[model samples]
Target: MPVGAQLLEGGRIRFRLWAPLAERVEVSLEEPGGTVHLPMEAREAGWYELSTDRARVGDLYRYRIDGVGEFPDPASRYNPLGVHGPSQLLDPGQFVWNDRNWRGRPWEEAVLYELHVGAFTPQGTFAAVRGRLDYLRELGVTAIQLLPVAAFAGAHNWGYDGVLPFAPAASYGHPDELKDLIQTAHHKGLMVLLDLACHYFGPEGNYLHLYAPAFFATDATGLAGRSIDAANPVVREFIIHNALYWLAEFHFDGLRLNAALLQEQAGQPDLLEALAHAVREGPGRERHCHLLLGHDRRAARYIHWHDHSVPRRYEAVWNDTAQQAVQEVLIGAGVAAVDRPLERLGACLSRGITAGGPDSLLPSAFVTFLQDHACIGNRALGERLHQLVSPRPLGAMVATTLLAPMPPALFMGEEFAATQPFLYFCDFNPDLIKKIAINRRKSFAHLPGFRTPKARARIPDPTHPATFARCQLDWNSVNHSPHADWLDFYRRLLAVRHRQITTRLAGMHEEAVQFTLPGEHGLSIRWTLGDDSVLTLLGNYGDLPLAGLQRPEGVVLWAEPGEAEHALNQGQLPPWSVVWLLRAAG
Candidate 1:
């Protein structure tokens, strides 16, 4: 180990570089006043290290090899220009926090809002996003899920192609700026969950493969795997260390692990257990507050069907199966099993993945959605939930309120019905850009009745005002007639969740949650607290009117035409609408 390794755990600035190709190495720090240089001592394995008493937390520094100019730290705290530019210094402890009273509400109470930082606001920087924290708080959202911020190839990207796992994208402001955002969110009572992509594949400005072959795993195609395999001790240590670094350095409340199907590999002796153990028992890990949120696709089998295992303990999976199930029924897909199970949708609200059955005829946990960032701008489906469900509010009500067991997530514009599309665009190396274009062309070519690539290239230029305009939340829409009415509908839906459902099920375990989705047009769900209190949530999924329904409880949390009507009438439901009923206290 180099002398710099001695201070790895301390706040003192220390530096190390694996530049086997270089004859000499020097560490340089750029202060607000001037630049300073520190001598590096060589160690075994072509590594160089240095420890300097002058360095502190906010020092902006990089390393120079031989006579070369300074390059950003491979593990930089901030890269304002994505991964292509210089690094910036950030002090994590400088910001004052306000989430002291927050003990992270359980998973049952979580309503997630997933947003891409680059597209979430008119200005993509962390400081710019502080304005919207209050809106999320008011919407009954318990967690705000941000896409990755790791340093990627260029000035703009999705952050999935990130290379520097430790660096915050410079486009999103410096590290301290992020701290301010988190602190601000916490003050407003919103927990922040950052999405982290471990399946690392990026083309430019990344020299990790050149520096260490041991860092990536080889697949059947011999392609380099993105995530660290727990089978490899050193690699596992690297990932665990990275996880710990973010928790301590950034004060993030939780991490949404990307693509759990890839991470939760079989015959791995439960890698997550090892990871949880490392974080729970590792030195100083306890000092920081954090949660490991696994974004898995296999929520049904692991979370409910089977007993507790390494993978089952994850906070939650993405629940795509549930999403799909709801969508299929709403879209009127006549796949025998689903069409026959009129109560299956209702069962979905209670039993979750099981609504699709153990060997689901269709995908359970469809992670169903009317419109998401992925389907945006593809000309494939457009961004309207009504377009997907038809007859408007009927399908909307079933999804928004009646779904059980599974927690639902929404994109930024879904609430008030913003019309802009979230396209998939990125700034990559020139060669990689060519590859992206070709691959996209090939993908569109396979789609029926599609010939031109114009629709595929619809992503707005990130630097343009149009891009920001496309991403901004349409707050004004909330007052615009039908859109405004729809916005109010979402509010009522949320109120139902809080005052009726979430309050009762907050502490209930997985088995206690149950659902029943009946036919293609309606769902009924049952939830019970302890052994005494119980309530049933029912919704009509079709157009026209569903009437003659009895209230399962003494009180109704939400209903069509107002709670005064007690019984749900289809005339009151409108098309694609939802409603909830709660039992009143005697």
Candidate 2:
């Protein structure tokens, strides 16, 4: 076996994998010429390691355990031919990264825009999506949170059911194109975070279990063929290595770990911690990056940091509680009471966890959002915004953006009132599609008008234009009245956030930040920066008029124009409206 240049530098590549059931394991390499096998030495705690004499970039490889079957490398490079194909060798040092000076924005500063690549544009390729970067930038987004773009079964999927963790989806363009997209984003000053699924493999072309038993737990609600469980050191290494590979090779700013709650194991020093440590310490090895956990539980939790800091190791978690709160207000669900249950939403934005205390949630801080791909997906790509705001589109915009303390995330086309539904569709997985449809029906069977069984059926043809069309952002919608108005409101809100909040917190101060609202009718807040400047934010969430909001001595920085906008200033919110004011910067 030829080790090629891999061992020439004298840097030892340690191999560790957890395969408890395997009697023996050997690494297999397939070059353009032929196939080769290298025997592995067993290490303690269910790990197999081998040093190859001839493995280098571009060589396709997998593992053969006890001569049973060929398996893709757990730390694979390219699922290039899709999930069922061989793993291609890739060198982490190849790509030239452009984000040298990028330290990444603080969690408080992030304005995330989540996008599904297939539905984001008509082309459904990484290269094609590059055209929209300027538009996102103009909307004041600091980061782009992409839905999974990993290789899955068939021609299309939402990317969540991706079976191959290493390969960027072939339909979405090749690995180099993905690298180019990241490079473009960095040059345009946008951080790119890939949504990674490490829990369950989607029902298309998944072969993890075929290669090895216990690769996915047989138990219900188990890892679902997508975990390198923490208890297994080799599995842990595989996952951590993949994460490190992305950060080091592609210059990705961070990864949004999907379904973080599922990979549960005790005291084995799991992949999550190892990945974080590697990224933070990668200046000598490669580069530094960030990691954000996407947890399903809305409850909050405390994150211990190396030093006591506002922003710690795990940058920020996703706050689904905020989504529920906004949903309540948007649907006009008993929102009048100021003392109503707000801790779930509040705690989500402030801390990562939902539970704070005895009848409360956790304390971990997180990123907040009003709507997302999942929320839209659950609604069968229906008109959720229209359902909420209806004639009061601007009102909905104000409430969603202004109320969120953690950086707010907006789904693509949400700003322009793109009426196209973000439907849940997957490539030709008949069995999985059937299950999905059935699951949707059972999940929403209790809803009043969801009585039609046919409406619950999954669209069998994922590659059909209709599947992608339903999720497409209707750029033409902007000219229409309500949609245009909504877009304008969002732009104004972004301006307010950047002009006021961004400047005030150029330096961190827990004491300086304050949330103030007088009564349940309206909110009047004054943020004093000691000597720099003061920012006053006023908003009204009710239908009636409000008055007697005392404003301190400062010139009005900016306000929404016209009657309805001014009405918001008086604390009389016209059913979900807000006005932001900034004191003149000295």
Candidate 3:
């Protein structure tokens, strides 16, 4: 039987929970007339089951363990008042879905635009994001990857602190509003990918420890409290079902498994692999479901790992190595201690990573980006790419990232270079808030600028409401002068990617793409398509113009801001610039 509150036929509802520690469990349904308590029948494997016709969709309820105080359901579909409040019954059949024909898109064709609901717009609700769907579509992104919408303790967070994996945050609007957003996105020919943190649950309002202590591994290690015991069958079922629930119920096209390396470290069954298998072979097989593993530098190479023994697979992994390389070159070599900076940057452009070696997957298997939420927001001060470098280099950086062989991910407002700082913001309790603020200041103590007392004071308190408000994007900047130019650059780059490059290189093997460093700061990337036509990209990372460069006898698809016909004809590559060329075979 399925877990949580499930509305059955004839307006009846069935409730179930896996509480090994509880000898007695009861369903406390808060009806309009009065509170109704019903004793649940004990089943095998420490399971509790209850069925009642009085309980219907929209009814508020919570679980009572052995006459203990009421607590939210672990598999709650809706938490109307937040994680600490009672769970609301939500019938999946009640909401109307219009995206019945939505098949979703392939990973290679994906141009991901990641956004946080709270900071994406002033309204900070799923309904508010519907108004911006057209803008994203116009920007040429095929998918919009949302930060976690899971229910958390407070009104605001980065979404990683979510305690209720099954419930969408009530602060972002009702569960149906989220469905509406996904439906609207599919109508606009956009796929929706949700970020999920399976490593650990948030500290606040976490009731898992209270009932099912076996859900957590005793030897697990992490700051986010005890790691979920992936070895437990009940835990595995809970997680696997949650993944399918988002896909089958809410219609999310895919999921980005955040910090997946933690799952691997726990020495348990590969939950990521299970998720991939469930998505592919389970009920979600009808939908084009994709999974992306979010790992740090060490485990990123696992995206290409294929063992006949293991049945699960991931479409791509977040390429932090490529992101760091681009960040280093654009910001300056001193920004990161990268050895062989030119070679590293060239490898990232030609292939996806420098350390992955020849056996590494194709660029399409790696999701590369210059500025993600973590790259910008995780710092003591959330600083954007534009803030770190000048406009010209930033433009070059954008071109380099998009024109690369890999799929590109753009953070919200990255196209327009929004000036707002995406600072770390959360609404934890006062005690946790003080701990977070102190740790944040301590992390930046080694940095030269932040070592000062004044700089330390500038660190925004994560619990402050103003910090979250300040992170909201300034949409008005899109029409402004310099920002408009940035937006146009992104638009044109993506147009070239879709119309010229993507289809030609779609199914080709990884070896078909070649990359070489012509000069210390100049890289030449060439891709040979099956049709015998070739696409080449030339990039110059130096300050002075690169002279004596060989020019390809092909159409100049694009060039740097001020250098186009003149630089190409003269065989002089502009400093900190990128040029795309295509040569047709006779």
Candidate 4:
């Protein structure tokens, strides 16, 4: 709304652009008759705006900066012709919203399932995703979190190389189709979250340097591209407004601000705080607009909990530290190395997984997962956790995270034990593609088998159509042998989670948790929930059966062994097995 084309009350369209250094800016409207170029009047703060009856919704237009050349609107609502093409005038009010009554669910009830739209279904469209809503709902997830859908360069991407922040990717269906999907998802009692590349715009389609160099200022991030100038008020407003647009216009239940922690490292804390304040004052007042940061422990200050046992700023943080520890415990010093993995995992499950200090937040403040896009896709072969670890150990780790006090997320097809590799596929130019492949191989070259160039060559080429296709979920596999059982396993855990643990997640005091190692490779952990219910998780992370553990007293929520009581009472747990229990507060 701050910098895009807005449809006014009288059928006139208002075009606005911030080209601080440009001497002149013109709105090039694609009329049926011919191209109509109108010079915009310069306003304060280097803003150029125009209101014209000639420009209407559905018309394609571009801004011509200083008569040098035409470029797509930076805040385009719909880039139907791709990032290099013109921006379509989309009227936000055109779509009839049916989700007015949907106020959104609490963060405590969140069981996030992260999926990329392009690889979610065969159709790879918003409508196709809508078709899978019932499956997701039945899968027992409380919410669905989509990877970035903003318009990017070619046909396929992991959704991170986004350039047009405002436009939904044309590959994922029309803007209205996405809105329809969100509305439908809300109707199905599922919350929808959009992951945003808030830290920086993608390299290829971005043209901000040409007209507005002030938009980018910092270089503190480890990302390949330059960072957004969070110090600039206008730049801050652009990003904050973009955040608001998705929440207010598209009706997303929440937003995961990707790479936002890097901003704090850049010493631009003002932007994040200002944005949080803006969201809370704006759309957050009307609904449960959960704000999640994609930072690890480094951004602890932003997620620090208040006396009310909730975050002082954002709702939650993506617990990369916890996930790493989980990986370390399951495949200790194997593919990914970490020292004292069981201790690491114990710390994560109890208190210090996130820096383990006085400033450490509540367990519920962390969103834990074993596999996400970055974890699996970044690998040379994109091998999932199932491929690396045995089924039993994998299941134990999954159960531990899902049943833990922290909210849990499942990467797309992880619930079904999907073999499909969530590969790092992108659509950049030939040079950039080569660069990406080289960079990827370089990152993995230090690994055990990938030291040789030949070994590295085995890594799938991201630009290849086959590589991208291989990432697609095999829907039929879910009903087959192990996959069906895996699906059932997830459903059982999630059903127990929302029914027992999730409802009592509030007031989860960080100090109320207890952790102890039952055997050489067993975890014994318990948490006193808000309602004083004692939630417990007992598991064996080793290949051998863990023996001589006291059986926790409570109702069984979920257990790997069929005869759970028999095994627990015997004071032993089978190899790579876990059990969840809930003791009613007396």
Please list the Cα RMSD from the true structure of every candidate, rounded to 1 decimal place: 5.4, 4.8, 2.8, 2.2
Compose the digit string of candidate 2's lDDT tens values, residues 1-586.
0111132345444333456677787777787778887787886655577765567667677778789787765445566776667777666557777667766665556788889887788787898788889988888888898888778777677887777777788788878888889889988988888887765666556555554446564533322335434455445555666666667667777787755533445544545656666667773234335567775552222234433233344665676656666565556452222224333333333333435422221122457676777776766435556555655534544544553445677888887777778776766545556555456466655555555676544432334547656676667677898788878877877876766565444433324445555556455555554245665556555565556555445655444334545564453445444555556656
Global CA lDDT of candidate 3, please?
0.81
Clashing pairs in 3: none
Query: Where is model 3 more than 4 Å wrong at Cα?
Result: 218-223, 261-268, 296-312, 333-336, 356-358, 530-532, 562-565
RMSD of 1: 5.4
The estimated TM-scores of all candidates read 0.80, 0.82, 0.94, 0.95
| lDDT-based ranking | 4, 3, 2, 1
Cα error, candidate 3, residue 174 (Å): 0.7
lDDT (10s digit) by residue, model 4, range 231-270:
7888888989999999999999999986552454555467
Model 1, residue 586: C-alpha shift (Å): 9.0
> Global lDDT of each model?
0.57, 0.61, 0.81, 0.84
lDDT of 3 by residue, 1-586 (tens): 2789988888899999888999999999898788888999999989999888988788899999999778899889889888888999887888888778888876667899999998999999999998999999989999999999999878899988788899999999998999999999999999999998765788787887888889987643323556687778888888888888988888998888865433555556776667777788965567678788784554454466343112147777777777777777776544456776667766765566556344445667778898899889866779888988988878877887786667899999999989999998888777687887777777787888798878888888877899999999999888998889889889999998888777665554567677788777888888765356787888888788887788877888778765644786787788888888888856
- Candidates, ranked, TM-score: 4, 3, 2, 1
Give the Å shift of residue 245 in candidate 1.
2.6
Error of 4 at 511 (Å): 1.9
TM-score of predicted structure 3: 0.94
Stretches of model 4 off by over 4 angstroms after superposition: 218-223, 259-269, 307-311, 334-336, 356-360
